[model samples]
Target: MATHHKADQPTLRSLTKRQWIRIASVVAVVGLVVAGGAATRSIYSHANAAPTAEPTAYSISDAHAASRGNARDALEGEPTYVNVTINGKTRTVLGTNFTDVKSVLDAGDITLESGDTVEPSLKTKVDESTTITISRAGAKMETEESKIPFNTVKKETSSLPKGTEKVETEGQEGILEKTNLVERSGDKIISSNTFASWVKKAPVEKVILVGTAEQQPQTTTDTSNNSSSSNSNANNNAQSASNNVGTTAPVGEMQQWAHDYLLANGGTEADFTATVYIISHESGWSVSATNPGSGAYGLPQALPGSKMASHGADWATNYQTQLKWFWDYCKSRYGSVQGAYSFWQANHWY
Candidate 1:
């Protein structure tokens, strides 16, 4: 009843412009914070940290090239600087503007020729430190190895009573060298001849020489009872000299030949040490060197004792005959007795 009296509520109106402005301001601040956060994240991504790498351990100490600084680079478009490797380690360089291969080389003070081939051509873009092999072009003749030729070396021997030459050693030759090779390219050989010398094809034949193969007959007697044995030997030797001119020599005479030849040449006390080896090898100082199987005889291993007779009629027992042959062999075959001795030092049979 009393409620309707004089009091009436005012009609409600819409939000004010100031209130809408305040709400818009809050939304703008939120949006700004979100955008700022995104921008910060992008900056962090662009600022990527570089990874760590190992350091090289190398040193240089010299006058000409050793004094130069160590330089290396991780190249991209162009190599900034040249790289020098030392002691299996790498270093770094900076501040260079080399563009092409030739330019880079030029900066490094390298020169090239027309026929020379570079690993990377001059027109190519330079990226990293590259190697270039410079080979000079020229014509030349050379020697090289080639295949051995087929050969058949036949032999005949009178030593065998069968009267037939037999092969001693069947040998296959091997190539030694190729010489005067013709060049086709710059300094390379296109074709060449095999200037090879064939190996000695002396057959190692088992010869059956026709001679006294049996041991020389000997009679053992008491030294006290043998009064004229030496004289008997002398007479027998003299008789042998008169008849068998090809194969008879006194042992004492052979020794004398060796001694005389050594003295006449350059035999010295030091050489005597070496001579001992020679004397021990060839007939044990016996001038009558004889290989009953091969029919080699005489002081210097003549093919047959008969051949020594060419030296003189007394070639069989004469010291001078043996000395001449031995001296000639030493001088012609070997430069000197000392040279022969050096060979003997290495080869016990020399």
Candidate 2:
């Protein structure tokens, strides 16, 4: 029983048309689902992948290089050179980036004291090759006391004996005050000037009085015998009379001449009084008057006696010549006889 039957093959005509369309649609739908699943898996994998960074205009390397360059420039910066003068001395200093005059001085360790001065001003800007000046000033006041000498004046008086002098008033010194302005540089003084001066005390003048009068002659008699006594008496009386007459004559003549001369020469009664006073004290109105100590001569007591020679050759003997010289002397030295008398009153001499 080996029978070989042929297997039946299926054909399109074995299904209805509606059934075939339904089967074809089911197949298309399954294929579309499979393709959509594959596309979705690819998109999900791309979204999950790591991203790459974008390039920038400036990099970290460039920033680091710029920072290093700035540091190098700061180290290589040039220093500012400045000249500074303090008092009278000048010196050079080096500074870096100093803004003002005060900062520049601070860089040099210079200090400013009260009353100190700066040429460019402390707030002024400083630069390379800038010059600055400083000055120091000081002032001090001091008081000093000093003495002023007094002057001595002399006068004549006929009330006392000749060649005698008496101090009428004592001399006194005076005081003065002075104020000065001083300029200095360091320890040296440049200049000093007197600003003010005043007298603290007024001086007192000295007064002195001189004496003038003629001395009387003395008479001596011998008592050895009566006859000798009589003769000595007569001779002594005659000599006394003669001496009295002679002494009076010269004085009267001198007084008359002085009065006439002074009155005729624009002189007043006061001047005549002063002239008589001085002449009486100086020479006792003697034409031949001479100073034993100084060789002074004449009524005016002309020193060296030769000074009167200019007036007259008979200055040693003539009363009128001595009087004329005396007038000239009074005019030249004291301006007037009254002035000479005032001087003589203070100094006991004219």
Candidate 3:
């Protein structure tokens, strides 16, 4: 076997002084580097970590000031309040900075229907306290059926005796279909106009025959006539004349008076014709005529019968006085008889 010799391991004491000094310097440098690295990590952790100390509190006065400023700004941005009435119901709404009435209503989601009306115009400006009123109106077409009255015609016959009348034909009412345009506003009818009308049935006119024949007295020969008989016949004739005058005084007097007065007051035959037409419908040319329903009297149908007293004290019995007052009224109010007739034709009254 080869000679086994034990080699000695190097020890610190066996190492040279210069090698030991170099080893010691290396250990010192490593220690210094580890300590500096630990110190730098501590500083970086302190700089980045969240604060743990109790937070400082602001003064109550400073906090209230900031809160008040925010509240003021919010209040200034708010809109103004206004009252709005639509279809009889009132409600509150914000104006939302709108300037005109239309804009304000639009902001409230209010829509207007056809023919609706606004108290203030849509283009009118709105204020803070302005009250908007809306009138709801609508128009629609409606159809209705009505009756038309028939007319009566008169004919005179000399063959029949006086005061005798005969009906030649019967009268009948006619049917008419009328179309109306109806306008309404808030439960009230604003207007109803007849847009079209059609006659469904024609009216039958009544024909009447009047008697005008007079009876003649029988005549005898005068061979037996004596003075006493002659005197008695004259007395009888005078009594008959007086009776005729008393009976004829009230009959046909008003029509005759109206005719005479109209001719004297710068009125022509045309005026007399219109006057007769009106009087025929009003009071039938009777001075003592009185309307039971309206309390109207006289040929002109004056209301209360006292209106005719303005003419004369004898207006109740005298047809001439009533006619004079009627003529003056017609001239001053209607300018002419024809004008009055025109109005009567439209409204059924003058």
Candidate 4:
């Protein structure tokens, strides 16, 4: 168990220095080959590299301008639609850059004239749901013709007898023109107002004349005589004819005028006394004498007062007209004034 063993070791070789020199030479050669390979791979990688791009330049303003142009183009592509009412006529239109109602109307080629109005002001912004209205409010003068009534007037005159009337002038209607201001909205009527009215033709008034005259009372006289009075009447007629030339009248001024009137009408101076006697009995030379019993009127004591109008309208008031009528009555009834006087002498009235 107690054995001690000697450990020894030692070896010696021949030619060791020459061998080490050879191995070092071979290592150096290998290192050179590896370095050449790495250089070739770096050249290939440099040839395969891609080229870099150049940088572009622009200002903020230019960029903004380009953006706005694009925005406008987009807006033009999509137009806003709106309805327009011009004078109550409605239509639809498409408008680009539609900023206000007026712009939309202008795009639709609508024009606004003077006195034209629009609802939803021209400055109002246009939208899809917006509706524009335009009204033509031109002032126009309208005229119409109308009629005017004439007035009737009356006047009093003494030339005609009482209770008599006559037309002095004819009446004519007049013409009038009335003007109005009319307003219309399209085909519908809105308002009308009268502005001016004037007479086109003046009216003519009707004139009537009325009479006013007084009537007198009538009385009778005695003319009774015998049949031999015919010779006396003839003598009386000759005496009256001779007295007609005298300046101093035997009777009063009215009898003188009656004598002249009868002479002017158709009676001779011989009929003057007989006429005077007949008139003195009938009406006492009263021009307006009226018979109360027989309703006879005037100096002639006509059966009806209106019958005297055949001779003249003034028969009731004119002594000459009554005398002429009396002369004709005597001629027609008794053949002559002398005959009438004789009848009156027998009857008291002829």
Q: Give lDDT tens digits, candidate 3, residues 101-188.
A: 8876665445666767897899998875678887655666677876645545555555457889777669776665555557777788
**lDDT of each residue in 54-113, candidate 2, tens digit only:** 111111111111111121121224445456665554544444577889876765545666
In terms of lDDT, the poorest run of 10 residues in model 3 is: 59-68
lDDT of each: 0.40, 0.56, 0.56, 0.55
RMSD of 4: 54.1
Worst window of 10 by summed lDDT in candidate 4: 54-63
lDDT of 4 by residue, 1-350 (tens): 89664455322344377776887889999988998889988988887878432111111112111111121221334545566664444544443578998887665545666677888999998777788887766645477766545545455555446899777668676665555556777876576544333344544546565655455464464435544785775576445433332121225566778767767878665577576545544444445443322223455555344456668877757776777777777788789877776776555555
Collision pairs in model 4: 223-345
Each candidate structure's count of clashing pairs: 8, 12, 0, 1
Local error of candidate 4 at 63, Å? 99
lDDT of 4: 0.55
My TM-score estimates for the predictions, one after another, are 0.25, 0.29, 0.29, 0.29
For candidate 1, write residues 68-88 as lDDT tens digits.
012222122332443322122
TM-score of the candidate numbered 3? 0.29
